[model samples]
Target: MALTQQQRVELSSLVGDRRVDAVVAGRARMVLWRDEGRSAEEVAALAGVSRPTVNTWVRRYHDHGVPGLADRPRPGKPAEVPGSVRARILALTRMAPPAVTGLTHWSSRELANYLARHEETRVSHNFIADLWRQHGLAPHRSGTFKLSRDPAFADKVVDIVGLYLNPPDGAVVLCVDEKTQVQALDRTQPLLPIDFDRTEKRTHDYVRHGTTNLFAALNTATGTVTARCFPKRRGAEFLTFMKTIAAAYPGRELHVVVDNLSTHTTDEVKTWLADNPRIVFHFTPTGSSWLNMVEIWFGIITRQAIRRGTFTSVTRLTRAINDYVTAWNTDAKPFVWTATPSEILTKVRWVHTEVRKLLTNNDK
Candidate 1:
């Protein structure tokens, strides 16, 4: 009962954990059947099943090796381009706007087409999708994005953000940003219920009540949030946000991190800054709004509180947002980051690399 050279390789394929693989290996054993290799009754008793099960395993062993037993992640033809091309595809994907490739936007199919024609890399849209999943560049729906004018923006923001990572005792770390154009959209008719099979849908022409600006300062220590809702976002509006923080905690030097929007740096804002000696403004390098923690939090509100929600008017939207904020503040705690300064720096370095090696439309 000596095994063949092919059987070893077959065993290797079934070495990994899988149901059928284990069964194949179990049946490949020499002891499974009697000396005459009578598997009929032995298979029925041991497997508590049919005679064909053991016979199939014996027949398969005579045919292919372990690779035949193991399930191949891909079943079709190999690509013209190897993993290097797949890596290239990912590098292209991480670039801010995938549209520069004349794709309007990237779907896996578009990427596959680009690869097949340009790189001479043959792949299916399905394979491109697999690549997308691997790279964490899903871009399902307008991923949170911002473009900075400063070439040194990521480094600068990383430096400012580092202050929070290793903050001094009793120091105030504030994430300040403006949420502009928060609107109130009222439906023509109140949202009506639908059948169990479908979701509620609304017709166009919903009423727009009005909009408001939210200037918020998140206290990194106490996990408290202080915000001001204004008709417009201006230096004046930002001052109100700062003043709210000032009143809430007197005698604390505040470390406020804000975006580089013009309204946040108006002449009036600069004037207010001169008077506020205790306030330190840590501006996220221009165009790096994602560095603002509030923006991250705002996304949560947009998804959970705003998206698909029907508001009767701007006032209604405003009230709902404020109400959600009030309720949120009552219990919401600031997110704690465990990533060390080195880890954050490492990530920013990669972002810088992404910008440097950005794949152009031609690179496809």
Candidate 2:
């Protein structure tokens, strides 16, 4: 039967409408398939029904329009699962399993079993899983988070973020940090290179040559990095790097953003800062190394070079680090900081509130 444009539109709408009963929707889809020149057998197979069933729906759709697709009233018992019960099931899934259950979280099987055991609801694990999918709930997975407990988090955030967003004119703003104890480890055997249907493979064991510390100063304005490798991460090494960065941007005042390490705040470092008068230090809040943009550079280098690299000695490792830094500076872009101090503090406050609620619940 040829469908008018209006009939085709209505049939298409019924086939796509999720609010319609699935049986009705399936029948609508069958009619659409027939309209598209599919034989009854093909339509039946696609609809997972008999050829007669497909023919019946197509004929009914032709006779009675969309109403023909709905299931006719039949003499049978209604569904046993109550709406309230399903709501309760969803509510339970959102909550932690009771202490007696000895579960950190709920699996579909566990949740179904718990419901059956406690409230005597005869639900299958598959049914529970379907319910979860329909409602978009997942109780099985979790992520890790930490609250910054720094007292001066606000002040430090504004200071560092300020330099990143609006740097001082004529002064150099550098994010300085040490990637400490970078190890040179060679695989026990040569790595098997990847090919069709295979991954690159390396031996589990490795030979540790030694470790070196990379002190890097990331130029916030231009994204170029000035780096030096050191055998030690002492105040002396840090001061030397500071001087190197200072000399690199000669005669300009330097605004260095560093994490609050003991070495960074040592009396010796303090005296050097006083001597250099033009070099100013802005310490990131305790435990918040993410504020320093150098950490982002460290992540890039580690992922691109250090993590999977094979090195025989600290010298080779240093050479690799220098090579990567040199390449990075050639095309480096400054890591832009977009979060305002108020925005950051607002998010931290929300996290703090969440942590407090968790602690309170635990206490109860």
Best by TM-score: 1
**Superposition error at 348 for model 1 (Å):** 3.9
Query: Which of the numbered candidates is closest to the native, going by highest lDDT?
Result: 2
**RMSDs, each prediction?**
14.7, 14.6
**Residue pair clashes in candidate 1:** 9-66, 10-65, 10-66, 185-311, 186-311, 186-312, 209-313, 209-314, 210-314
Poorest 10 consecutive residues by lDDT, candidate 1: 192-201
Residue 115 error, candidate 1, Å: 10
* CA lDDT, candidate 1, residue 344: 52
Candidate 2 residue-wise lDDT, 67-131, digit = tens: 88876766888466777667667666655567788865676778887888887888866667778
Q: Which residue pairs show backbone clashes in model 2?
A: none
Which regions of candidate 1 fall more than 4 Å away from where they truly are?
A: 1-89, 98-129, 138-151, 188-207, 351-364
TM-score of 2: 0.59
Q: With candidate 2 superimposed using the best TM-score fit, by how many Å does residue 138's alpha carbon deviate from the native? A: 18
Error of 2 at 173 (Å): 0.7
Instruction: Rate residue 156 of model 2 by lDDT.
Output: 87
